[model samples]
Target: MNKLAWVLVSISFVVGSSAHAQKEIPKAEGYDQCPLGYINTLGTKCVSPIYYEVEPTYGEACESGWMNIGAGYCKKKTILGIF
Candidate 1:
């Protein structure tokens, strides 16, 4: 039926768009070089693209345990466990 075909098309479109939204960036051995759309943290871990927003800091400082990711946005740092 036409309705069934439309439903299949819709589902395929959604799946395809979701898959294309985010491409996995390879992890680096160090904290300096992160692929596009990822932020390099102090622990050498790359955060998500959602946290890579740039805002105005206006001379304010980031909170404790959070790193100032340029502009005014502060991203939480990854804490390694001693265990």
Candidate 2:
């Protein structure tokens, strides 16, 4: 009886956890499903490649170790240091 109860409890726990797992996201209206890390807002639009703000240089030259990206902005230059 003890073994049977434990088995049933374990089964219920597994099923319950699975049931609470995230469901498939529906496709955006008139578009395919959104890529990972992207989300569909308002059920009618899928925003991808989200936008971000970049700090402006305000007419100053790019700081050392940074490269000028034009338009008064600078972007950090990556150094691979690979031989």
Candidate 3:
């Protein structure tokens, strides 16, 4: 056994080049028109927009009762405010 036939041809060429480098991301064409909070999950790649707080505008300045909640941070809008 010549080193088990070169280790079975190097383990089938490393499992056929890792199954052809696992590639399967081709289906774009308005990928479900990703927008609000974006998310396409590989239909062509769009997942990237999950803000949770901080989105106020016009001279932003949240504090007394907190507001802005888009992606910067400012929650407490109502909860018997205290902290």
Candidate 4:
């Protein structure tokens, strides 16, 4: 009987803890709102935008030995030779 009661208590505690953890906290005022493709810095809490090189347009001429992969970018082709 005591073991059954303990099991019930343990299950309830696990469920309650999980529910509490899933709750979202409201953002406080004066907090920086990070833009798209940006992330908040850990220490300073500043917004750091991520940047990437501009990809070439599709159907455009690619450099020699490179082929367009249809994702606005070109990739170098690999040639396999017998060892």
lDDT head-to-head 1 vs 3, winner: 1
Please provide TM-scores, in order, for all candidate models, with all chains considered together: 0.30, 0.31, 0.23, 0.27
How well is each residue in 1-83 modelled by candidate 2, as lDDT tens digits?
A: 99999999988965764553232333433444443434556564434352312234656676776665343434444334111
Query: CA RMSD for every model?
Result: 11.6, 16.3, 18.7, 19.5
**On residues 1-83, what C-alpha lDDT tens digit does candidate 1 reach at each position?**
99999999988965654553333333443325544446656454455544322222345786665566542344444433110
Which regions of candidate 4 deviate over 4 angstroms?
Answer: 23-83
Q: Which 10 consecutive residues of model 2 have the lowest summed lDDT?
A: 46-55
User: What are the lDDT scores of the predictions, listed in order?
Assistant: 0.47, 0.46, 0.42, 0.40
Q: Model 1: runs farther than 4 Å from truth?
A: 1-8, 16-26, 50-83
Candidate 3 achieves a global lDDT of 0.42
Top model number, lDDT: 1
TM-score of 3: 0.23
- Model 2 bad stretches (over 4 Å): 1-54, 81-83
lDDT of 3 at 23: 25
Enumerate residue pairs that collide in model 2. Answer: none
Per-candidate clashes, comma-separated: 0, 0, 6, 0
Misplaced by over 4 Å in model 3 are 23-26, 30-83
Better structure of 1 and 3 per TM-score: 1
